[model samples]
Target: MDHVVVEPDSSSFSRVARALDDEASGEQWRAELATDLHAALELGVATVRGSLMGMATGGLDDGHEPLRQAVSASVESQVRMSGRGAGARIRARKITLRNFVNAPKRLNSRRGWRHPVHGDTETWVTQIGAPGWFDDPLRRLHARLHSAAARALDNRARRIARRG
Candidate 1:
C-alpha cells in the first residue's frame, strides 16, 4: 500500500492572524480611514462652495450685492458616518436677510419687481435676477461629489491592501 501526506501552509495563516490580532493597528487603520473620509468631505465641500459662490455672484442684476454675498456665505456642508453607512449633506445655512430665512430660495426664484427710481416721482423700473442660481450649480456638481467620495474610498482601500 502507498501512502501520501500533505502539510498545511502556516506562514499565510500566521500573517493573517497577526494582522487580525493587532488591535492597535486595526484602530489606527480605522482612524486613518476616517481622516481620509473627512478630508475628502472637506475637499468636496470646498469645491461646491466655490462653485456656489461663483454661481451666486455671476450674471445677476448686480444690484443685490448683499444678497449675493449672503447666499455665498451661507454655503455649508456636513459629513456623517456610522456603523451602517456614511452621508454628506450640502446646504445653504439659513441666513436672515430682510428677516427672510429663505433668502437663498428667494434669490434663486426672484423675477422682476417694481422698484421706484431714486428721487424720481411717478417713475418706476423692474429689477430682475437670474433664476436657478442655487440649484443649477448643485445639479451640475452632483457627479463630481459622488466621484470624489468614491475615489477617496478606493484610494484608502488600495493603500491598505498594498503588499510588501
Candidate 2:
C-alpha cells in the first residue's frame, strides 16, 4: 500500500481560503488558518467523493433507476455549482471536482479488478483521480458494496433454506 500524500498548492486553497477569509473572524482566522483550511479541504473532498460514489454505485444492487437519477441530478447540480461558484477557479476543485466529469468515466472503465479465474467477476475499485480524490473513496465504496452484497446473499440463502 503506497502512502499517497495530498500535496495541495496555493492555487487549490485560494477559493476556499477567500471564502473562509471573508467569513472567518478574529481568532478563528488567526489561530486556525491551517486547521481551517485542512478541515475545509477534507469536507470539500468528502462532498466530491460522496457525489462520485453515489453516482457510480447507486444503482448497483437492484438497478434502481430513481436512485441513479437522483445521483445524476446531484452530480449535475455539483457541476452547475462548480460552473457558477467559481467557474474553474475554485480551490476546492483540485481535491474535489477537478476531474468531476471524468470520474464517472474512470469508475466504469478503468476501476474494475477482475477475478483471475472468474473473468466475469469484478470489483469496482476505481483506478482514478490523484491521491486525495478517487482511490480512497472508491476503495471504501467497494468494501461497503461488497459487504452489502454479502448480507443480501446471506439473507437469500436463509430464505431458500427456510423454503426447503
Candidate 3:
C-alpha cells in the first residue's frame, strides 16, 4: 500500500484538552479528560475499529457489516467494523478527524489513520502508538474467538462446512 504521510495539525488536541481541563473541575466526575478521551477516540480511530469489527464477525451477516472492506470504490463503506485512538494525547482528534474516515495504516515511524478533511488526503499518525493493535491481533484472536463463539452456538460452522 502506498502510505500517505500527513503532518499533524498542531493545535487540535491542545484545544480539546484545554477545554476539558477548564470545564471539568467539579466533583461530579461526570466530565473528565478520560471521558472526553473516550468520546473523542472514535473520531480518529473509527476506521481501525470498524475494520476489526468486520473481521471478527466476518461470517455473521451476509447482508451488511461495518467498515466491511478496504479499497471500496463506492462512497459506501469498503472496510468492515470491529472496534479498535487519541490525544495530540486531544488536537489531532479535533482537527483532522472532522471528516476522518477510519482507514488506519502503518506510517513511517508512526502508525497512522488517514485524515480526509481536505480534498487531498493525509495520513495523520495517532497519539496512540500502536496503529492496528486491534488489527492483526483481532484477526488472530477472531480466528480463535469466532471458532469458540461458533462452538458455543452449537458448532454450526463445521456442520455447515461438512454439509457443503
Candidate 4:
C-alpha cells in the first residue's frame, strides 16, 4: 500500500486542525475529532471484515485470511488509541469500545433513513438517541473528523506533488 508523507512545513495540518477547532469550540472540536477518528478506525475494520468475508466466500481466491486479520487487528488497535482522544475522554471509558463496534451496525441499520437536508444519500444514525450531551456532541465530532481526515489526505497529496 502506498502512503502519502506530509511535509512537516506544510500548513495543511495546522489548517485542518484550525478549521476543525473553529467549526466547533475547543471542547467540541476535541470531541468531534475523537468521534471522527473512531469512525475512520471502524471503517478500516469494516473494510477488513468485508475483505475477509469476500475471501471466505471465495470472492478473493488468494486465501488472504491472515492478511485480513492482521489489517483488522491493526485498525482495531488504532481505533483503541484514537478512542482515547479528546471527545472520547469526556465519555465513559468502558462504553467507548462498545460504541465504536456498534457504530457500524447502527449505520447499517439506518441505510433507509434519509437525510433531511441531503435526501437519501446523506443519512445519519442515532442508535443511542439524541438527547444526551455525549450523543449529539459525538455525532458532530464524527462529522468533523471525517472532513478533517479528507482534508489531511488531500494536503498530503499536495505535499507529495510538490516533492515530486
The residue ranges of model 1 lying beyond 4 angstroms of the native Cα positions read 1-65, 83-85, 110-129, 162-164
**lDDT tens digits, residue span 46-114, model 2:** 554465545433223433233323323333212111234521111222111222343333343445322
Each candidate: RMSD to true structure? 8.0, 24.4, 26.0, 20.0
Q: Quote model 4's TM-score.
A: 0.24
Per-candidate TM equals 0.53, 0.25, 0.23, 0.24
Lowest lDDT sum, 10 consecutive residues, model 3, at 88-97
Q: What does candidate 3's lDDT look like per residue over 25-139, in tens digits?
A: 4433333333433443333345444443444322233243223242111112112112342121211111112233443332111444433332335644233224443444444
Please state the error at residue 84 of candidate 2 in Å. Answer: 43
lDDT of 4 by residue, 89-123 (tens): 22222221312433322222323222223234366
lDDT of 3: 0.35
Deviation from native of the Cα of residue 76 in model 1, angstroms: 2.4
Candidate 1 local lDDT, 12-94, one digit each (tens): 66665565455226767667666666665565456645654565232335355466666777876655555454666566777
Q: How high is the CA lDDT of each candidate model?
A: 0.61, 0.38, 0.35, 0.40
Weakest 10 consecutive residues of candidate 2 by summed lDDT: 87-96
The superposed Cα distance between candidate 4 and the true structure at residue 99, in angstroms, equals 28
lDDT of 1: 0.61
**lDDT (Cα, 0-100) at 117 in candidate 1:** 59
